[model samples]
Target chain A: MELYLTKNFGKPNAIAMAGYLKHGGYRALRKVLKKMEPKDVVEEVKDSGLRGRGGAGFPTGLKWSFMPQETDGPKYIACNADESEPGTFKDREFLEKEPQMMIEGLIISAYAMGVNTCYIYIRGEYATQTKILQQALAEAYEKKFLGRNILGSGFDCDIYVHRGAGAYICGEETGLMESIEGKKGQPRKKPPFPANFGLWGRPTTVNNVETFAQVPHIINKGASWFRGIGTEKSTGNTIFGVSGHVNKPGAYELPLGYGLKDLIYKDAGGIRNGRELKAVIPGGSSVKVLPADRIDVPLDHDSLTNAGSSLGTGAVIVMDDTTCMVRVGVVLAHFYRHESCGQCTNCREGSAWLHQLMVGIENGQGKIEDLDLLMDVADSLEGSSICALADAAAWPVQGLVTHFRDEFEEHIKTGKCTSPDSFRI
Target chain B: MLSENAKKEIEREMAKYPEKRAVILAALHLVQKEEGWISQDAMEEVASLLDLTPIEVREVTSFYTMFNMRPVGNHHLQVCTNLSCALMNGRGVVEYIQRKLGIEVGETTGDERFTLSTVECLGSCGTAPMMQIGDDYHENLSEPKIDSILETLK
Candidate 1:
């Protein structure tokens, strides 16, 4: 099937405004503005079953309906380009290569949600892609697609690029808003959510770059066609960033319900020299680890959720037999520990303690009972934070220790890492 | 002190936000681009310009990784030592960089030209064993490639 997300990827001048317009770029926005009412647009998306491509998988059209249509003050839309989840780099590819898709998507979405001001919260390290997006934005403004009275529709919307400093938690929607508000990238407690009170305390709708990019497609191609593309629940195509121990490790746009085994073996070129697949982090590092025996799950939200994992950000990090699961545990522990925002006691303390435990086990100072203690710490951290980060921090430890407790037990018993030094190049 | 161009850039970013306080990150980026690493003086200037306290700026500055707390070497070697890269010899690249520069992960060369440090991930995991040197990503690293890259640096 021709990829919806990456259709214009290899085409010349794909990122340029001219090239984008030539291939029917902002045609959806024009159609949405010229023809459909705001509510009708929302209805189309709700029927399409388009979910947020950023981790949570919330329905996009329903999220748009949450905006206060009769509110007096300004409304905002945040495009989450802060793609910092470990094993996920797909947003950068889309942002750099197909800038207009994001612009058009957000413009259409901004109009539908009654938002005149929008922000694209890009990750700090995306210096190159930021420039690419900036050029696209400038071109968008010059062509009267942005600014006052866009295309004589009497609607005005302006998009701004906000660069985030290197903080992983800021990828969380609330945390992202807080960072854009010039504070530490700490996540706010939910209740009065962003839809009601967000971005300087205004009604806001935040969606990922991928989610917004799909809006134009939904509008242009109709919701039914979009629904027909992916699996029933997880509609439409999504990008998967496949990395680690794969031969052709890169981002590939595939339908949502594509099999996990096919993603690893067929799409990513199968474990670098036909090596035996040992395990896989089905989503980003935050999702649970799946043992080699359970690689047949469809790469969609519901199927992966059923398999005790999430299709988060669609980042599939494959591991060959030569890859050490114990070391993988350590690396992820370090990441969570380093990224804990220090607001939540459980995440802040638990992530540190988990890392210490991993370090102790790696250095052969761990007690056998430390295995259970690791699980104990992970258990305590789950559902104990202001955001899902606490849960994210605890997942790898839980998944690895749950699936591979023998490995952790062996390390403590032998007082040494028994896994072969597979990566000591 | 922030330069004229930096101030102009900061002002341009400030106008985009509904709240001027929101431009703090953008202001920090402006300072870092002009001054290599954000200096104590630059923080105060940004805080003052944005109607923020230096402590507020410091709080944000300390929060993020890209905002270097100290002055960086002219060529900052940020290697990805996270899971995906580590599986592909990112650690070896770190070792090679340390051996080549005689500076451990967080140390700078005596010449102050190169600073080698290992970071979590730069999101180039697809092409593993990558390092970001002063905003440019050098991926698929090998011992000889590091040598040639270092040789080309001077």
Candidate 2:
């Protein structure tokens, strides 16, 4: 229940080494190097039940175990700072404000994984964050915490920042590695995943900025302490990035399995301007949305899944009654269509088709039969691509139509939107 | 086609990676940061510096949206109209900027001082109805805030 990830969020100079060290920043890294063996470090994380914060929710410890214990060449660790998921800005906080915590976590991860070289593949749109992170990296190196013979433990590690050039697809682990290799940021067909063949053909592991940031805490606090906080399955605290149509919207760090309704009504200070809550996208925009009535469900990976949604990135985007579901469909469809890497035909072409269909429906040219057609297209794009992007593109459309069928039908029948305060497309 | 400083920065970046191709994005970023955009000639220069074909460099540039294929105005105003932003009248922000700047979403002002663009999410969703003017984000935007931001830009 104690806050670890964002404890020093608004502290002045928290991004600097002095501020970070004042609050016991690199103590975990020192413990990791001086006391724990590589296997113990990995085992401790495994027992913590920490999942990937980058939306997939894969167990962090399991992911580290996949890296070969002994490698012939250098291994690499890529911290995915490419926080491009719509409605998600949790990782951006770590990158811009508490960067040292994330960097210390990264150094610990490198030590655990036997990685000497690492890269933080950040998105190019984060120009301010990139600068702050660069400064933090320099501070770590200057203090002998980053490069060669760290804390006299004879452990050598170097971290670099590789800025991505405005590609959302590059956030995918393989796409990220490809982007780091200076190639088109497209997800490669995975069989030889990053564990075996990755990053210029060296063994590599990619963890989210938030995921790596959790390691230092787990190492310092122990696994059982982390496990006792949240639900048995979903342990530890995560930053629930609450945005949109809320009275007090921002990132709130709370334990997993937090109530979705409380997140909207209590943590975010309820819906903005006394407007009635209409829908909630509990995860990033890619996850299926839940109607206001269904938000009584808990905010964890499994509970949301049982309710027919995924806890992707913990980005809760709320909508008031004034918002139009059809227009929401249009905007999200446009994002997927613009972001699809065009490698998969279903994703490339289907996302475009979905967007076109949504626009027609929004513009009052849709037919009632088009509703069925939209569902058909969404179904096809779900599992037919090389990556989950096609599924990501499909989920929002599916969630909107499934929950807001009456609205779509109303638009089709009346050739007009019913939402009184719907904005221009 | 690239400045000596940019070339030097790109070389330093190349040294960090095992292969030279890995620095192509950094190299292109360096050129675009200096010249306001990447030209075909500049792509060729970048390709040679990284031991890649001009088409290879061009392929990478064309794939990413951040690289300016053509020139932009002095200030690039990228407004976010994604879901969260849209809920807070993000589209209205775009329309307002369009009216204030006397340009469409993709057009530049005549004096070459400002260019207006409607971008996807830039991850500042907490402060919805926001725009990115170069590196810094103008969050919690309103007509008054936009006016103040524009005045400072000049």
RMSD (CA, Å), each prediction: 1.2, 0.8
Highest-scoring model, TM-score = 2
- Fnat values, one per model, are 0.74, 0.89
Candidate 2 regions off by >4 Å? none
DockQ numbers for every candidate?
0.73, 0.88
Write one digit per residue (lDDT tens) for candidate 1, span A250-354: 999999999999988888889887789889998898999999999999999999999999999899988888776678888999999999999999999999999
CA-lDDT, candidates in order = 0.90, 0.92
Clashes of 1: 0
Provide the lowest-lDDT 10-residue window in model 1 chain B: B96-105
Model 2: per-residue Cα lDDT over A253-365, one tens digit each: 99999999998899899988888999999999999999989999888989999999999999999998988999999999999999999999999999999999999998899
Of the candidates shown, which would achieve the greatest DockQ relative to the real structure?
2
- Cα lDDT of model 1 by residue, B17-105, tens digit: 87889989988888888888988999999999999899999999999999998988999999998888988888889887788788987
| TM-scores (chain A) of the candidates | 0.98, 0.99
